[model samples]
Target: MMNEAIARNPQIQSMRYSLSSRFQAVLLGAALGEILGTQCQVMQSQQPQVKQPSQWTSLSRWGFSDSTLANRIAIAPAWGRVAVQLIKGLIRGGGGETSWINEVLDVLEIPFEQSNREPNSERNSSEQDEGSPLPDFPQIDAGLAIAALPIALFFHADPHQLEQELQQADKVWRHRPELSDGVLAISYALSLALREQLDPTQLIAEIVEELELNRDRPTTTDPSAPSNSANFVEQLRFTQSLNQTSLDRATAQIRDQLSKSQTGLDALTIAIAFHCFLNTPEDFCLSVIRAAQLHRNPQTTCLTAALSGAYNGISSIPLSWRSALSRGSSEHSPLNHLWGVATEAELQQLSDQLLAAWSGAYDLVHLLNYPGQTFAIAAPKVIRPH
Candidate 1:
């Protein structure tokens, strides 16, 4: 029965479905990003809303890194893994727990295992000093517990309960210092989505307020405005910055119309624009990409990463990007009895091939700004200390 359940898992099943071969093909395309993407962060903030998320955490998309929304769905998951690993690594290192963004790969190297270990670990720090490269996900219980929360939320026994927990977490996060920028972004996107179901009017109010703020408009001049100044209802919504008097009513209507949508990629479509506000504490550009995915938007990342991966580089794609370390044989596949996937070597080659073919941006703003276009920029920006 346990095996049956694991066999039925979506992500697990996905690896068995004919889709698995394509996944390798995609992975192959990604190799170019290892060298190409580091140059992407050089594209300075075209404006405030598009700025990279590594600065200060705020509701401003201007700070989003040049990571195109194309690859966000894929990147988000790795962030989930990395965030959990850091907390656990820190605890194991005797630093106890710190911010969610503390680097875990630096201090400890552990396999991504489900089993727990001793609280006061017997492992030596000398191992790190000896120069062993860190493994992807650390084998720490605290990290697993924290990392598992999002996964559980993704496939909760009761999504409503998880939503409630998320709401509570959001409130608690507002006052917590240890919370990372990625966590806050995840919280905000979740809040926006939850509000859509629980108190839709509140969502509208926020939308209206967000638009007004974007346009530098007085949300409500009337004295009868709701105590929550942001609760003002408006017929139009525009996230465009500064220029309220030029309210493009048609465009605002379109914005609201789009939000009402539940089509494929719509939520993530808006999410990429929304997540641009995130700011990670470390230089891990992948955290921001991961934050975009915590909301369950992977296809968005696939496309964006193909294009923007060249600029953003692999570092932005969390080190935990590989969900599976070794490509298990077909015996483990769901089709063990009926079919088989490519061998590990075949899969690796396919992964590299697919990555090399990826030419899409991971950031959505780029899509809005330039659709189906790829061009070289002036010399990429110089590196600065994190």
Candidate 2:
């Protein structure tokens, strides 16, 4: 059986190889989108015309935690930047414009090249986080979800299209012959779901239909095989036909678990589009859910529970990060110089806001998929320290 074979394959044994490569793709895409998203809308300006922090600090308006944003950008902006780059690459590859990513890059004064993709030949390359709790590789579902960047934000979208992307990603993973199917698919789910708002019930129905379809098929359906794509397309059509309330009921059950499992936004990132990037706060929760549903690992479930307990009163932006630029020197500051210098207190606040954004993103995802469901839950629970 392909499932059994895949599980035993030596290449799939380590998650490191797969996760790092995904970083290159997702970060590139996100960077491009962010640069374009920030163009006309008022968040913060690249440069100030006045002495007012209000004019210079557009991120303040969007509730950004400047200290945390700086730390994240410094620590692993490669993830976000790579995502932006990928979108630009995709655009250019398709013969579209590249100006969007370029604008953000120009303003931020960041690199035009992809940051994290270490050349395979270079022995120094690795997936390990620089002193963060998140794993270096896609060892867990939550971890994989985090590694997949913006896609995780889109999980609550229409499953038909998402599934296609997942399949394509899987195709690449399978060719590598070393990645976990459950791990990769979960990551694939998260990547597709990012930055897109959808109806929850619609998303749930589509997923349910997809599960049934996958359950009924051969593991290695050949692309060259007749009607393979056709059958997949039919599944999407079928899920869309479901009644609204039914879809909502199913989605509610899963969402409850997700809400319960959220611990913090330590893992979330600040996106140019607030909806696009979710840093890895307690990704292990979602990862565990994937492991359980897919029968992979039990910690995925435990992590989810742990995260839920930790996620009581989170704020998206840490106060210290928020204040770095909130009160600052009059000099024209280098982005890196201004981004640094955060107190522990500031980091905590930024963390809370990041969690809130993820929660908001999750809601939007469900809404986009299940256009018919009235699946409105209260806002994300925030956790603040004494």
lDDT of each: 0.29, 0.29
- lDDT per residue, candidate 1, 65-110, as tens digits? 2223222222312322343343233223322133222243233343
**On a 0 to 100 scale, what is the lDDT of residue 338 in model 2?**
27
- RMSD in angstroms between candidate 2 and the native structure over all alpha carbons: 21.0
> Residue 227, candidate 1: how far off, in angstroms?
11
lDDT of 2: 0.29
Q: Candidate 2, 329: how far from true, in Å?
A: 11
Task: List residue ranges in candidate 2 displaced over 4 A.
Answer: 1-63, 67-69, 72-77, 95-164, 171-198, 219-386
Relative to the true structure, candidate 2 reaches a TM of 0.28
**For candidate 1, what is the TM-score?**
0.23
